[model samples]
Structure formats: C-alpha cells, structure tokens
Target chain A: METTHAARAGRGMTALRRTSGIIAAVTLTTSLAACAGGAIGGGTEGGDDVFKVGLISPVTGPVVQEATAMQRGFELAIEKINAEGGVLGQPVEVVTVDDQADAAKSTQLAQRLISQDQVDYIFGTIPGDTTAAVAQVAESAKVPFSSAILGNAGVCGQYFFPFGEPNASLLNGLLPQMIADHGTKVALVGNDYAFPRGYFADARTVLEELGATVVLEEYSPMGTADWQPVISKIKAAAPDWVLTAVVGADATALVTQADQAGILDSMGFTGVSLIADFYPGLTDRMHGLTLVGRYSDQLDNEANKEFVDAFREAYDFSDPIPSVAANAYEGMLMIADAVEQAGSTEGADIAKALGEGEVENGVFGGGSFNEDRFFMTETARFEIREGGAYVPVETFPADIEGITPRCA
Target chain B: MDAVVTLALSVFTLFGFYALLAVGMGLIFGQLGVVNVAHGELVMVGAFVMFALADVPFLPRLLLAVLIGLVLGVVIERLVLSNLYERGFLATLLAMWGVSIVLREGANAIFGSTPASVRAPIQENIEILGVSYPLYRLIIAVVALAIVAAVLLVTYRTKLGLVVRATVDNRDMASVLGIPPRLVVTGTFAVGAMLAVLAGALQSPLLGVTPMVGAAFLAPAFFAVLLGRAGSLPGAIFGAFVVALLSTVLRTYLNETLAQVVLFALLIVLVAVRPNGIDWRKVQWKPRTQPAQVAA
Candidate 1:
C-alpha cells in the first residue's frame, strides 16, 4: 500500500513539473519578444504634414558605439533642421528602432516601419548584412534607405544610397599611402564577412594597379578571441604592412591579441579597424599608427568645427568623434535638401532630387552623389596620437570616385 | 619549427581557458541536472568586475571576482533555481536563459554598450623557441591548469567528493543515507561558478570587455562539456583538449569559415557516434538522472 502511494506521488510530481516548465518557457519568450520591439523618441505620429524617417540602429550589439553615434547624428540633424523651419516647411519626425545588428530583426523592423508606421524614408544600419536586409524591405515598399558605415558589396536596390566611404574612396587613397610609406608587400586580414571580403578585393585591384604584391589575405570569423594563428601566418608572409578590416568587438580583440603577440610592432598597421571610436579601448598601444580616411575631428572648417562642438556638447563625448556620425549628420542634411528640392516626401521624388543635389560641404568635405548613386567621400590622413586623438597628417583631394555600381 | 612552437603555445593557452569553463559547467550539470545557460553571463560578470574595479590591483580584483561569483551563485540558486529543480529540465533551462538575458541587459545598462579594455598586469612577452608569447597568457595558462588540478584532486581524492557523487548518482538513496543533497548541490554550483569567473577575470586583459564578449566563450565551452560524458569531469577536460587542438589546427590550415564548418561537422560526428560518451576506464562519473532510475 505504501509503495503504491509513493509511485502515484512521483508521477504527479513529474506531470506538474513538466507543465510548469512549459508555462515558464512561454512566459519568458513572450516577454523577451515584447522587450525587443520598441520605438525611440516620442509617440508622435508622422502625418502627411511631417517628414517622418525611420532609423534602424543596432544600439545594443557588437557595433553599439557606431550605432549609437549614427542615431545621435540622425536625431541631432533633425533637431537642427526642425529649428530651421524643418524639412519642406514642416517639422521632420523620426521613429528609431534598435535592431541589435541582426539581419532578421532589421528585416522585421523595416517591414513594420514601412507597412505599419508608414515612414517616408529608412536610414541607418552599421554592417552590410543588416543594411542589405533593410534595403530589401525598403525597396519593395519604394522607400529611400541609406547606411552610414564604410565598405559595400552585393547588388543593392535602385532606391538605396550609401553615405559612407565607398571602396575606391577609402582604399584607392589608403593603400597607396600605406604602400608608399611602407612597402609593396602587404597582407589583408579582416573578419570573414561580405564587407571585408569586398574591401580586400578592392584593395587587391589597387595594389595590382600600383605593382604591389599581396602577401596574404585572411578572413577570420567574428567572435575570434585568439589571433595568434593569424598573426603567425602574417609574420611568415613577412608583409611590410598589414591592412585589417576586422570590425566590432572583434577589432579590439584582434588588435589586443596582435599587439600582445608582437605583430603590431613589426608591421605598419592601418585599416577600418583603427577607427577613432576604438582609441579609448586601445589606449597607448595604437600610438604613432597612421591611416587615411574621409573625416577627422581636426579638419579645419567652419562647418566641421561647429559640428564637432555641437556633437561634443550634445553627447558629452570626449573621444575623437567617428566619421560615421559625420556621415549620418551630413546625410540627413543631404536628405532634407533633396526633400526640399523635390517638394515632396515621396521616396522616388526624394531619390531623384538627391541624385542632383550636393552635400553642402557637410563632413566628408561635401560633394554631390554621382550618376551611380554613390556618395563620393573626400579623403584625409590622420596619425593616432598617444592620447587617443586622430591628428591630421595629410589631406587628400576628394578625387577617388566610387567603384562601378552593382545594383540589380 | 618556429610555426610549430607558436601553434603549440596557442593551443595550450586556449586549452587552459576552455578547461576552466568546461569543468565548471560539467560539475553544475552533473550534480544538479540544471544546464546553467547563464554560465557565460557569469563570465561576463567577472569581466565587468575587472573593468569596473580598474583601479584595484589585478590579482586582488580577480580574488574579489571569485568571492562575488560565490555569493551570486548562492543567491541565484537559492532564490530562483532551487524551487524549479523538481519542475523538470525545461523550467531550469528557461530560468537560466532568463537569468542570462537579465545579466546581459543589466551589464549593458550599467556599463553602457561601449566596449572597454583594461591594461594587462604583465605586458611583456617571453620568447619561446623563437616565438614571442605574451607573458600574461603563459601565466594565465599555468594558473588555470593549477586551479583545474586542485578541482580534480578534491573531486577524486576527498570524502566531500564521495558524498557529492553519491547524491548525484541517486538523490533519494543518498538522502536515506543521511547525505544533505541540497547543500552538496549548492556548494558544487558555487565552486563551478567561481571557476568560470576566474577564467573570465584572467582573460579580461586579452578581451574587449563587453556584455556580449562572454557569448564567444559559451559555444566552445558548451561543446566541450556536452561532447563529453554527461557527468564525467575528466571527459570534459579531454573534450576541451580536442576542441582547442582541432580549432587551432583547423584554423591554422584552412580559411576560418571552412575550418569552422569542418570542425562543427567533426564534433557532431563524434557526439553522434559516442552518445553514451567515449568512456575512459577507471574514471567514475555520477550516473545520468534517467539512467540513475535504473540503478534505483
């Protein structure tokens, strides 16, 4: 009788436990899904009168700093534009969402922004993958989309415009400068992704054009903590300089491990990985490193100086403000100008006006979008200082036009 | 010859970190039947601790991380996990998953999403066989191995080990034998958590201290634990060795993408072939819970 009673209790306990487990799982999943979907700024709707733009920034992912800067630049530009009688003589509204750099999440958010929120334009995404995802959604809906990060690959939609430095603008100027300073033998190491692969391919063409030999091309996956093996390979190749495209948290890890492994001391290091945003994390390790890029906080211009001051005051950010912020802020101005020229918030009308509009000397020394719909960013060189500053070394003319567009 | 030395040292350094992580996970899973998905978050906590206490000396900071890990482990187990253990596997898994998100979001809220780093206590390099290896990495490897060794000694050679193992093998039978299963389970989990915290503290200098950084260590460490016999600690160590060796060798040879594919394939094959675990003679593990029913 006692054995029968114990057996019955055990079965009852099992059934109760399984039921509770299922309930807990369901509750947690629902709560998380809810938390992930939220909008920034006010709940003010974008009616026909307001120039509403949907901003997708990965504010919590590996690219959080870059994403945060993008959002700040977008919001700040809107604030300034609204102060100046707004875009098309009305206040410009923005609905921002954090995608966390996930492609699917960005896709879902983009759909909601278009079909649900009824945003006129979609702006911002850090990595190429998420950019492509957002572009796909925005294109089907005939909405204008732009990204503010560097490097591009794959076939994009007609409505897509990249405000970041294109391959030719970034590498055509950077590789030659690096090779002239270092040597012909160079290695390309980046995190294994579309942008890096395409970035290196562009670098290869430029190197071949300059009669330079590519010693090694390595692409490690994201989240790679140990870079010793990659370092050993580069050391074996004995490249005079190593141009890396490693990005996000992986950038810091690669540089830290490479520095510890004594690779940075031997090779001339410069690439997208050595951005101004990474200065604080690198500290004194990156001192004396030189790289060429579009914007520098030290750029002596009235517009840029004002921007730097405004950005610092608004965000209380002390480090060298990244070029992406400049790109986004300037891109917003360009967008507003296009909207004004078109006299309409329709996506096609805005795209048409932007194709003929100039950037008003925004951050990348200002230029108009080419027939290819690529923003021809200007170039300048900066030396990373001991105190985490990008001191301008040499300024290059904004002569490097973009590569041939590959939009489908 | 130079390349070989570098590769060997790389494997050794990686192995040291993986061993610490896998062993902790093994102990917790084996004793409590809870697959603490928040194990990696605990590591993130340790890294953040180092980042937060930047002015504190490195060694003392590591000690403090260990203490904090112990306290946090006890609190989590007692408050959230203790009641849920009898509720079955899914409950504990979901609970731990919830804990992971909370810790990650909490860290993000506190530290902000900007990645930060601290200076390595030892910045110099020691050349070995014509290869320069970071002195800090070598020291960390040695220390990790020493701690893992101490864990093994206590686990295999101590009476506490016997009581813990017995309770794990059969909770009801051990209870009838006068063993306090709850205390043993809690203590095992605390020690397990502390080890992971130590690994993170030691690795912080080489890492970009971010909330998401711990996510990187989770997969390989998890593979190390699950690839082994479910309850066997030594098996977890062997599994860690395989992971470190395979990853180092594969990444050394093939491009990282292809190497990762091949590595995943091979691990899956190994696990599929030896679902009962690649048994090693003379090593004892607590029987898995379902299997313990047969013993009962």
Candidate 2:
C-alpha cells in the first residue's frame, strides 16, 4: 500500500514537471517567432514617399563589433545625405535587419528586405558566406545589391556590386608583391572556411606564377582555441613570409597564438582581413603584421578623415572604427549617389547608373567602377605597430590591375 | 623532425584537455547513471571565473582559477543537480539539455557575446627538436595528469570510494543501508563538475571564452565517454587520448569537416559494436536479496 502511494506521488510530480516544461517551451518559441515576425512585418506601410534602404548585418553574433560599426556607418551616411536635401528630394530611411552572422539568416533577411519591406536597395554583410547567400536573393529579385565588407570574387555577378577588394584580386596583387619583396617561399594559415580557402588558392596561383614556393597551408576551425599544431608547422616550413585570411574571434586567437609562439618576428606575416579593427586586441603583438585592404584609419585623405572624425564623435568608443564600417558607410553614400543620378529608386535603373562610367567621388579615395561593377583602384597595405595603429607601408596604383583566371 | 615534434606536442597537449573533460562526464554517468549534458557549461563558467580573476595581482591566478572551479562545481550540484536524483534517463537528459541552453544564452547576455581570454600563465616557449612550443600547454598537461592521478587514488583507496561504489550499484539498497545515498550522489556530481571547471579554467588562456565555445568541447567529450564505455575512468581517459590523437592527425591530413564526420562515424561504430560500453562487465548490479522473512 505504501509503495503504491509513493509511485502515485512520483507520477503526479512528473506530470507537473512535464506540464511546466511544455509551457516554457511554448513561451520561448512564441517569443522567437514574434521577434522574427517583427523584423519582417513591423515597418510603416505604404509610405512610398520615403526611400527605404535595407541594411542587413550580424548584429548579435561573433562578428557583432564589425556589424555594429557597419550599421553605424550606414546610419551616419544616411543622416548626412538626408541633411543635404535627401536623395532626389525624398528623405532616405534605412530598415536594418540583424542577420546574426548566419548565412541562412542572411538569405531570409534579404528576402524580407525585398519582398516584405519593399526596400529600394540592400546593403551590408561582412563574412563571405553571408554575402554569397544575400547576393543570390538580390540577383533573383533583380535588386541592386552592394556589399561593404565581403569582397570575394564569387560574390560578384550581374546584379551584385562589391565596393571593396575582391578576394582573388587582393591575393593576386598582394602575393606577387610579397614574393618580390620578401622571398620565394611562404606559409599560409587561415580559419578553415570558404573565404580563406578561396583566397589562399588565388594567392597560391599568383605566388607560383611569380616563381614563389608554397611551403605549407594550415587551417584551424573557426573559433579554434589552440594554434600549437599550425604554428609548429609554420616553424618547420621556415617560410620567408606567412599569409593569413582569418576573421572575427578566430582572428584574435591566431594573432595571440602567433605572438606567443614568436612567429611574427621570425617570419613576415601578411593577411587580408587583419586591420585596425583586429589589431587593438593584440596590444604590443600587433607590430610588423602586414595586411592589405582598401582603407586604413591613418589614410591621409579629407573624406577619410571626415568619416573617421564623425564616427569617433558619434560612437565615442576609444577603439578605432574598423575599416569594414568605413567601407559600408561609403557604400551607402555611393548607392544614394547612384540613385540620385538615375533619378529613380528602381533597382535596374540604379544598377545601370552605378555602371554608367560616371566618376563618383565618395569615400576611400574615390575611383570609378569598371564595366564589371568593381573598382580598379589602388590597394593599400599597412604594417601594424605597437600603440601606433596600422600605418600605411605602401600603395599600388589603380591602373595596375591583376585579374584571376577562374579556377575550373 | 621539427614537424613531427610539434605534432606530437600538440597531440599530448590536446590529450590532456580532452582527458579532463572525459573524466568529468565519466564520473557523473558512471556514479549516477545520469548524463549531465550541461558538463560543458560548467567548464564555461569556470573559464569566466578565471577571466574574472585575471586582474588579481597577488596569488597565482592558476590556483585561484582551480579554486573558483571547485566552488562553481559545488554550487551547481547543490542548486540544480540534486533535484534530478533518481529521475529516469530521458527526463534528466532533457533537463540538462535545457540547462545548457539557458547557461549558454545567459553567458552571452552577461559577457556580451564577445570572445574574452586570459593571458597564459607562462608566455615563454620551450624548444623541443628545434621547434618552439608554448610552455603554458606543457604546464596544463602536467597539471591535468596530476589531477587524474589524485582522483584515481581517492576513488580507489578511501572509505568514501566504497560508499560511492555501493551507491552507484544500487541507490535504493545503499540508502536503506544507512549510507545517505543522496549526499553521496550530490558529492560525486559536485566533484565531477569541478573536474570540468578545472579543464576549462586551464584551457581558457589558450582558447578564448565564448558562450558557444562549450559546444565544441561537448562533442569530443561525449565521443570520449561513449567510446570509453559509459562508466570506466581508465577507459574514458584512454578514449580521450585516442580520439584527440586521431582528430589532430586527421585534421592535418584531411579536410576539417570530413575529419569531424569521420570521427563521429567511428564513435557510432564503437557504440554499435559494444552497446553496453567498453567495460560493460565491470558495471556491477547488486543482487536482489530477499528481505529477512518476517518472523511468523
């Protein structure tokens, strides 16, 4: 009788616990659904007078810092443009979407921006994978898609406009320079992902063409903690130069590992995404690290200074605004310029104006987009030093171009 | 030669961390028959505690980190795990999984989703076969080995060890025998959680502390537990070393994703071949002794 009563009591408690669990699960599911729904359907409706641009970024993921900066830059540019009588006398309003740095989420956000919000233009995404996903949506919908941070060649096609250095071009241009200046042998290290592998392959082809020997290519998973194995391989290879293409949290870890292992002093290290944004965390370890990009905070140009100053005054954060943010800001301004030139917010018309051979001076030392909708501009390389941020070491002329033959 | 030495050093260092994680899971599942899926979260908490202690100037940060891990382990066992005692496998599994999500998300909210890391205790590199390696990793390996040895001694030689063993065999019988099985179970859980904390605190300097970082450690730890047989300490440690070595070698030679898939497939195969685990026979089930016939 006692055992039966105990069993009944236990069953009763179990039932109560299960009931609580179901309620909690439902609440969580509903909250998440509502947040996603709000992102897709919560904008002021039928307001055709306002030119709405959708800005998508990883606002709450591993790359939130970069995403936040890009968002700020876009907002700042829109503010400035609106102050100057707006685009085509209609105030430009941006509808921001948080992709959370996930590729699938980026795709969904792109669709929402196009079909749901009816945005005039879409901009911003840092990682290559996220950009690639968004590019497809833009192309299918025949909407003008311009990216600020992701500059992989794979992202460039009919409907996409990349406002920064394409992966292949950056590698082709930088690798040969590295080989000519340093030596013929180099080691490559990067996060194991699509962007790094794609860019490294480009660098390998360029290095081989320049009679350089590829010593070793080591990859660590994204967010990997240990670098001993890879660093050990780098040491063994004894390459004259090392090239890296990791981003976000992994970027910091790799730099920290390299600094700890004394790889920076032993070999010349160059990377594509290692910039002022990633350098601050490295402290004294930032010295002698080489990287290539479109702009640095130290670029002595009026437009660059103005953008930096405005960002500093607005954000009030001590950290230097990342170049990714600056590029996004500039990209937004360029899109608004193209829209005004076309005198319409139609995607097709804006795309044509963007490629109409007009010399538009906006930011990052202005250059006109070529027939391919990518700028044939000077590439900037900087050497990071202690306390002093990424100081510009050299700049190649805009006319000097290198095209990567597509790999089969 | 340098490459070989470096690879070997990496394998050993990785083995140390993996072993610590595996042992923690082994203790919980072996002693309590409850799979604490939130084992990795306890590690994350330990890492954060180390991050907090990083600025203190006086005592060795490493020691302070271990102490923090111990406290966290005790707290988690007392507050969360004690209630789940005697709960069936499915219930405990679901509860722990939910706890993991809450802890990970809560960590993101508190830590702001940014990766934070503490500096390695020793920054100097040790040269082996003309290759330089971080001395901190070597220290981690030594410390991990020491803890393992101490745990083995305590479990094998102490009176508490006998009570724990009996409790694991039959909780109801042990409690009826005046063992206070609940206290024993909670104590073991706390110790297991502490082991996880130690592993994370030691590893935090090498790997930055991110909310989702626990997911990475969890997979390998589970693989180790499954491969070693559910409850064997020695089996778990051996499994951890083997898996770590295999993963490191495969990653070096094959594509990263392929390596992960291959390792998980291997674990599945091991489990299939030995459903009762590697040391199934060692798990003793107490015989049902007839209650003394009530006097007529």
Best by lDDT: 1
Report how far off residue A62 is in candidate 2 (Å): 5.1
Task: Kindly list the per-residue Cα lDDT of model 2 for residues A56-103, writing each as its tens digit.
Answer: 867766677678777888888988899898888877877787777778
Error of 2 at A80 (Å): 3.6
TM-score of each: 0.91, 0.85
What tens digits encode model 2's per-residue C-alpha lDDT throughout B66-185? 676667656766776677755765566667777777888888777654456667768998988887788988888988878887786777778888888777766677788999977887
lDDT of 1 by residue, A223-247 (tens): 7777777887898899999999987
Scanning candidate 1 chain A in windows of ten residues, the lowest lDDT window is: A1-10
Runs of candidate 1 with Cα error greater than 4 angstroms are A1-47, A401-408, B170-180, B282-296
For model 2 the local lDDT of residue B114 reads 45
Indicate the residue-level lDDT of B253 in model 2.
60
Q: Summarize candidate 1's per-residue lDDT along B1-296 as a digit string, tens digits.
A: 98889889989999999999988987777556677778889888988899899999988999999999998888888888889977866687778878888999999889876677877899899989888879999999999988998888888899988887776667778889999978887888889988888888889888877888888887787678666765678888888989999999998988888988998888768876776456666655676466344543
